[model samples]
Structures are given as structure tokens and as C-alpha cells.
Target: MKIDGSTVLVTGANRGIGRALVSAFLARGARRVHAAARNPAALEPVVAEAPDRVLPLALDLTVPATIDAAAQAASDVTLLVNNAGTHAVGHLLDMDLGAVEDVMRTNCLGTLRVLRAFVPVLERNGGGAVANVISIGAFGGTPSLGGYPASKAALHLMTQAVRADLAPRGIAVHAVFPGPVDTDMLDYVARNEPAFGDFPRAPVAEVAAAVLDGLEAGEEDIFPDAFAAEVGRVWRADPKAVERRLSGIT
Candidate 1:
């Protein structure tokens, strides 16, 4: 929906794309923005930028208590942005089970938890929108990212299901599939897997701006960057071929 005059809540707002989203929302004239991060102290810079409009919130998606607390604290939120996620790069079979679980918990179940907690809030506030920051990896398996793609794939499906379920309630559900973004998360992956070193990355501000633009345009599935748009077009043209290509990327 519209960003202006809306109360928004964004998770993982400490840095990277999340931080950019918070700024974009403010720039678009959101009445208030709840910037949630695992560490509230890390949100100081964002809050300082707009002390009256930004509220720093402590939220750890994996922690149900923190999710509940954030929901309670941000009752006026009309737009919810599920942007917190983790990447444990490795082969699924060889990676530590704990790491896989962490990825699933934060990316899938944790996002679901936030949605569940916020449904009533949205309903009470006359139903708004939910924007989930998923990835192009959701379309196919990336051997290097392992369970990270699997978790996102699950989230993509969940976003579709939620969209259908929430339509009658007036709450819009948008799924964002962004390709490599210039963020710390991608930096970490590039450091560990040289294969990603040459992948095209979109600026964080551009991606965030495109996402909001998509929402304003009522797009259910948003490919926010050039790389993502190209990959999405190819994947839709031939899913199997794209899968095979990704499989060969090492």
C-alpha cells in the first residue's frame, strides 16, 4: 500500500538493505517507522536520523518472545517488512545441522511467526501490507548456499499462501526476490565462496526504492534489481534450464 502516513515496522534494520528500507520509508513520508534489530544499540544511527519518526526496537526473529514484544510495542504498524534472515553457506548434506536449523528458523518459521503476530494488528488498523524480502535463490538450489535457498523457497511458498489468505482481509502480501545486493550478507558469501565474486550486485538504496515502488504499484511478486529481473525472466521461460545452470555454478 501507500507509504505516506503509514506506520511501518522493519526487521533487521541495523544495516544493509534493512537499513536502506527504513530510510526509504522515511523518505517516502511514513508517519513513523519502527526499526527493529537484534541489537537495539545498533539502530542508534537510524533512529538518530529521524528521532521523532524512528523508534528503535529490539527484535530477534528466532526468539518468539522478542517477536511478541515487538508486536506489542508496535501496535500502530500498518506495514510490516520481514527482512531479517541468515545465510549458512555450505552443502546441505555436509553442513552442520544447527546451521541449517538456524537458517530455517529465521527465514521461514520466524517470518511466519511475525506474520501471525501482526495479522490482528493489521486487521485492527484496517489492514495494510506485508513485504517479505526473499531472494532469487528461492527459485532453485544454489549448492554453495545450501539450506539458505531451501529456507527461502519455503518462504516464497508461504508468501503465496499468505497472499491468498489475506486478500479477503484487505491485507496485501508482497514477495521480493532480489538478486545479489551490495550488502554485508553478500560480502560474507563472496569472502567464503569466490564463485559469487563476479555476480552483479544492486545498490541497497535502489533495491529498497524499487520494492516500495512495486508495493505502490500493487505488484505481488517484486524483482527489485536488474539481475533479479533478468533471472526471473529466464526462470519463468524455462525453470529446468535455469535450475541446471544454477547447479553448475558451483
Candidate 2:
């Protein structure tokens, strides 16, 4: 789908990759951008910069009420960016069940919910695209991240399924697998394990630009960053080898 002049809805747009996505879309000439986050106030800076193009809305992916409310507010959105996610760091067996559930609900189920709610909007607006921000964790195994990796794996599968289901409707579904970026999630992980400092990190703006480029290219799966692209190459060659490498990292 063309990036310019499209109505876009970006979840978790208050900060990190989500915030970068909002700015990238605006820079790419989107007609409007809905900056959705748990606290709408967090989007003040983005709104301040582009008062006429950016709309701030309260959106908590884990909360159905908030999701529904945000969907209603962004009823004209043609592009949906599922960037909201939760991370639980620990061994799956030792971690809290609630934490695991939160990750799955936010990263997996929440994405689907937003898509379902926005399909009609996309259909009305000539069927645009939905970008689901997945991770290398979707294919790789890292014991330290616990259920977070498993949740991303579920999202990866969901992305494929959504593409198959939505293709007939002309709604393009693109899955993004980004390796360790210099986001707070990685920062927290790095604090726990200094070795993470050695892992390659991409700037959030670069990742966002890559995502838009992939969307414009009509790609089904996007590994926007170089590190993620390298990981994808290895994954395709040998899934087991990739798993073994991630196992060593954790």
C-alpha cells in the first residue's frame, strides 16, 4: 500500500518503536495518524508537532474496552500498526502465569482484535495494510525471555494466517521480525545480562523507515533491520541451528 496520505492507527505510540512509527508515518506524508496508547496524554509531543495530522487516543491492548474505544475513534484508519507488546523475562516454568498471559494477550490476541475491529474501516478506505511487529524470538528460542518468545512465535503464525484470510479482502498483512533494537525492552534485558550489550541494535527510526519501505514493497514478511535479516537467513537455512545459537545467548 502507498504510505502517503493514508489514515494510520498505531498502537503503543507513546514511546519506543511505536513512537518512531508515528513520526515515520507523518514524515512519509500520511493524511492522519492516530497515536494510541494506554495514556493518551503521552502523545502530546507528537500531537503538538502535527496538530492537524495526529490524533491521540487512549488504547490499552490488554483492555477490551480501551481497544474498542480506540477503534471507534479511529474508524477511518486504513493502516493498522500493531506495535503494542508486553515482555516477561525469566524461565517459563519459573515465571508468573499472569505475566505470560499478559504477553500473549497483548502481543498476539490484541493484534488480532485490532485487525478485526479495523477491517471495515480498511475496506471502506480501499483496503490498506496491517503491519504486525513480530520478532526473531518468534523463531529463535531464548530461555531468558520466557513466554515472550513463544508469544511472538504465536504472532508469527497468526500473521501468516491473517494474510491467507485477508488476502481476498484486499487487506495486505505484513509481518515484521526485528532483532534486538535499542529499545527499553532491550535496555532492561541488558541490565540483567551485560552480554546483551554485544548484540547488534538498530535505531528505532531506521526500523520504522524499513517497515514503511516493506509495506510499500508489498512484502508479506519483513525483517527490516540488518541483524534481523541475517537471523532470517540463518533460520531459513537451519531452524535448529538458529535455536541452538539463541540458546547459547541466554
Candidate 3:
């Protein structure tokens, strides 16, 4: 769906790619943007950009009640952006189980909860679009990512299934796979793991712009960065090769 004049809602809109998306949407002529975050206070700067068009809502994906409330409040939303996610750094077998579960809960189950609540809202608004901020990790596993990749892999399948189901209803479901982004999330990885300190990271604004461009072009699977595009092509050619490369097992 076109961003022009669309009423958009974005989750995790406090910082990183989420914040960038909110700005991009407004720049692209979105009529209104509901920026949802666990801490609505963190969204003040984004809301200030367009006081009349930006609505800051308290939404915690981990909280089902909040998701329902957001769905109710943002009923006129024509585009839904699921961008909240968590990550744990460690091997799956060696990482703290609690951390792994937290990643799964937020990245997988939490996303699902948001989708369930908003599907009806979108339908009521005459069938809008849903864009899920997935990751390149969804295609394979990395020894340092722990359960983050697994959760994203699950989300990938869910995106596809939901796309098929929603297509009949005129609701478009799109998945955006972005490689490492220059955000606080990547800063954490660089600080904790020196090995990835020099990894190429895409600018948050660039990635966000690509996502909006893809949506307008009717692309269902969007690679929003150069790294993501290359990785996606490799994986499509040979999944095992990409898996091996990610695992550092080649």
C-alpha cells in the first residue's frame, strides 16, 4: 500500500529502526502515525516532529492487554509495522535459558499477539497492510546469536502463512529482512563481541526508506539493506551454504 495519506501504526517506536520508520512514514506523506512503545515517554521526540499527525501510544507487545488496547485505539490504521524485537548473544546450548526464552517471547509470541489483535482492526478499516521487521538471521543460525535466529525463523514462517491467509481478504503482509543496522542494538553486539566490531552496518534511515519503497512497489519480501539483499540471494540459491556460512562451520 502507498504511504501517501495512509494511517500507519508502528511498534517499538522509541528508537532504532522503529524511530526511523516513523520519520520516514511522515516524510512520505502518511496522514497519521501511531507510534507505540513500552515507554510512551521515549517517543516524545518522534511525536514532536508532527504533533498533529503523530500519536504516541503505550504498547508493550509482551503485554496482551496493551496490544488489545492499541488495536482498539488505532482502529483507523492502514499500515501496521511490527518492529519490536529482542536479542541474546550466546550459543543456544550455553546461553541462559531465561534469556533465550525472553527473546522467543518478545520476537515470536509477542509479534503474534500484536498481529492477532490488529488483523481485525485492519479488516475493519477496509483491508490494509502489515509489514513485519524480520531479520536475515531467519534464514540460518549464528553461533553468537543464541535463540534470536530461531525466533526470527519462526516469525518468517508465520509471516508467510499470514500472508497467504490475509491475501484473500485484501490485506497485504510484507516481511522486511534487514542485515546489521547502525543502531544501539548493533552497538551492544559490537561492545560485547569484538568479532563483529567491524561488521558492515546499514544506516537506520536507509533501511527504513527501503522498506517504504518496497511496500509501495508491492514487494512481499523486502531486503532493506545491501547486506540483506546479498544474503537473501545466496540463501535462495543454497540454503545449506548460507547456513554453513552463518554457523562458521564451512
How do the residues 1-250 of candidate 2 rate in per-residue lDDT, one tens digit apiece? 8889889999989889999999999999999999998998888997887999999999887778887878778889989999988897877888898988888888888877887788888888788889999999888778888788889999999889988988999899999999888899899888876778789889999999999999999988899899999989999999998899887777
Candidate 3 lDDT tens digits, 26-58: 999999999999999999999999999999999
> Top lDDT: which candidate number?
1
Question: What TM-score would each prediction reach against the true structure?
Answer: 0.99, 0.97, 0.98
Q: Please give the range of 10 consecutive residues that has the lowest summed lDDT in model 2.
A: 188-197
Query: Backbone clashes in each candidate structure, one number apiece?
Result: 0, 0, 0
Instruction: Rank all candidate structures by their TM-score, best first, as comma-separated numbers.
Output: 1, 3, 2
The Cα error of candidate 1 at residue 80, in Å, is 0.5
Q: Alpha carbon lDDT of residue 247, candidate 2?
A: 76
Q: Which digits, one per residue and each the tens of the lDDT, describe model 1 over residues 1-250? A: 8899999999999999999999999999999999999999999999998999999999998899999999999999999999999998989888898999999999999999999999999999999999999999998898889789899999999999999999999999999999999999999999999999999989999999999999899999999999999889999899997788777777
Clashing pairs in 3: none
Strongest candidate by TM-score: 1
**Best-to-worst lDDT order:** 1, 3, 2
